[model samples]
Target: MGDLTFEDVTVRYGSRRRGVTAVDRVRLTVPAGAVVGLVGESGSGKSTLARAAVGLTPVTGGRILLGGRPLPRPGRAGPRPLQMVFQDPYSSLDPRMTVGESIAEAVARDVARGATARRAEVTRLLELVGLADERAERYPAELSGGQRQRVALARALAGRPEVIIADEITSALDVSIQGTVLNLVRDLRRRMRLSMLFISHNLAVVRYVSDIVAVMYLGRIVEYGPVDQVLGDPRHPYTRELLAAAPDLRAVGSDLAHVGSDVGDGTPTGSAIAVGADRVRIALADVEPADPHHPPSGCRFHPRCPIGPMVHPDREICRLTEPDPEPHQHRAACHFAATVETAPVTPARRSR
Candidate 1:
């Protein structure tokens, strides 16, 4: 199995006065040959987790393992089993190097190959990513956004990695172009049997590409499950909220339009957030101010919760005590998670 696993992973940055716990204790297992989508807003720690996976960021606590092997610490050479495709194609590529050369660099580093062999492999990669051999001679400045991204994909694949972490790889492309990249990734996954962690804020994209889905809030995963279970019948309030926000033909005439506004509120409710059929109970009122250095009191989510209206069995205690992640059919963190229901969604009004 090409599985990737994280056990109680936590990452904190800065000193007491200005520090932030970018990622809280998070545990996840991504099965081999599956595309798992990590969804969260800009500061929700999705990027942090992605960087940590490929050894770009340090793990303050916990461990990351690929195929049962622990990954090296940050700033060190990773196991060479994982590679990442960054969000911005424009910035990730070298303006000075041709697409062919960029791919060549990655291939050479991973595989001890001479110039001729690298060139041949680069040509094959270009074809695999749907780029023409002639396009390899072109520079990043000379290609379209989609083409540039394709080159980025080619470069990542050059390492022949078993696990690929694609962080917002298609966010910069037009909707039409995004589909092309998504299809390419889907194809590659099947052909190479590569396991991937596809991170994106766009639910539709996540649903389209993922075999399983993991939803993040603040710095922790709130809900995770098989794509069909999580996307088709989301159990957690947060998961329901995210699904409601996704644009879909089936969502017409529903109150889902207000999803954007609700999620942006940042209110921490004493409720459970799901993580792959497991539940984590957290009490908002009890959450201590996440340490100026560490911040591990009651519930980190209590500060901005809007669902206080819903009374739960452990509302009082949950409001005062820190809850831990409990294994459920799905995973979540919330003291009263079992009692919480999906909040009512209101559709956005169209201008007359």
Candidate 2:
């Protein structure tokens, strides 16, 4: 396995006049033989960053490196050390070629070999992915969704890549099948000592596969650290919200009280009663989603932040300047992240 590093990477789409910045000066590293899980909601640039690692997307600024070496140009005449397993296996594989031929083709690209040798290599790759040798004869449409994805993995393995970018590979399969695929990937990573960037919206799935976790929001990493520290003691409000939203009954102390409210009559009403026995809520609903084109002045999340000046006094810094990613016990991008405990959540009601 090789080290994968994103050095201040920035990816923008369209022209300067009307463009969208997908990844903004993101700096992250995936060490050799380690699995890093990147989690975020839709449109948070997780997939964009993953594509950049494999040279599938153009970088508006910054560079991507493998083992401290710059990535080769796409059309360079050599085998690349990186491979990607995409979300839709059906679309990624060749419909015309059988599974065996596809894997053999990948082998041919990676190494000059005769037909018999290519077939032998394909058999070994299939066995590595837990597929029978004869299953290679099946077509993409003839096999089950799980089998197709397995074939995709087998093909990726044929390249002998140092790093594997797994982008929501099991997203299209059933839950049971997803588990089987995840198990297979975990086993293969350990046996091969492979480095992987596992990108998914499912926090649980990410937690299951990743040694390190990075939480992304609006094209920035809000929190990143070891999985246990980042997920168990989440420092970012966004991370807390994501974890709280997905409750795991089996996990100890995983429940969080819902602190949302409704908007009506120009007043926000909440579940918790406020002073004077009246129910008051922070106007989180009034906060509009940030436009990727314009963004906000200071913190991109301040508008939707439920706990700030409204909860604590003299917290105007949140509106005036953005907090750089700070490395304490965990890395977080919030000015009041340390003072978050003092911020109000549900105020008690006064007896009237």
Candidate 3:
């Protein structure tokens, strides 16, 4: 395992002018032997970044570094320095081939020079992932969802990659099986000291195994730091909003009755709900995410910023200046990030 750095990496699709920017100048690092949890909404580009890291997607700008060296072009000789285990094991594995054959193909020739050596290596990998060597002879259709995922992981390890990118690897499994895969990942990291970029929207899953957490939004990394510091004492407003919306948040807090009504003709217009019963819905800025094809002029999040022009019309700065996520103890991409909690905006009822 080695240090994996996304150095101002930018990934775009289509022409420069009309293309969609999937990862926008994101800067983050996965320290050697550390598991970095990448969290964000579905369209926030977490997966795109992971795909770019493993050469599945092309980088439009900047570069990705492994151990401070540029990533080699794809289709090079020898074992891959980086490997990826995709979200769906069913699609990632070939249904036509036996798991043993699949895993054997991934084994570097140097690691297993002969037929017997390759067979032994395949068996060893199967046992390493808690699967019986005999099970390797079974097709993907013959195994459970969890077993297929385990085989996918074993195949990745066959390459002996320096860094592993696991993209929502367990989200597709049942909760019972999810824990098993997670525990296996934890144990594997401990046993192999593997550097991993673990992507998931599940905050609980991220908190359980990651030493560092980086939150992405609309193709940009909005916050990142030690998992404890970022999750425990979040500096970014987006991060706070995520924490407030956690499924268990209501377990400790009392629910409030709905207040305020539609402003005109009893129609539910965007501005009708003056004060939402709960703040977790991005109350002040209940708008859909801006299109990446044509992002906002200044802050990409201004249209949905809880503390920006949506709440304080006088705070025109947010609509005019894009903020960079400068490095800090708990880095965040926000202008009014520090004052987020101090200047809470309690929505007032709109005059009838």
Candidate with top lDDT is: 3
Cα error of candidate 1 at position 324, Å: 3.4
lDDT of each: 0.71, 0.75, 0.79
> Candidate 1, residues 130-245: lDDT per residue as tens digits?
98899889999999999999999999888888889999998998866776787788778768888999999877667666788888876888788876666655555555545444
Best by TM-score: 3
How far residue 116's Cα lies from its native spot in candidate 1, in Å, is 1.9
Which whole-number lDDT from 0 to 100 does residue 11 have in model 2? 95
Q: Better model by lDDT, 1 or 3?
A: 3
Candidate 1 lDDT: 0.71
**Candidate 3 on 277-299: residue-level lDDT in tens?**
24536464458778879888777
The 10-residue segment of model 1 with minimum total lDDT is: 263-272
- Clash count in backbone of candidate 3: 0
Q: After superposition, how far is residue 34 of candidate 1 from its true place, in Å?
A: 1.0
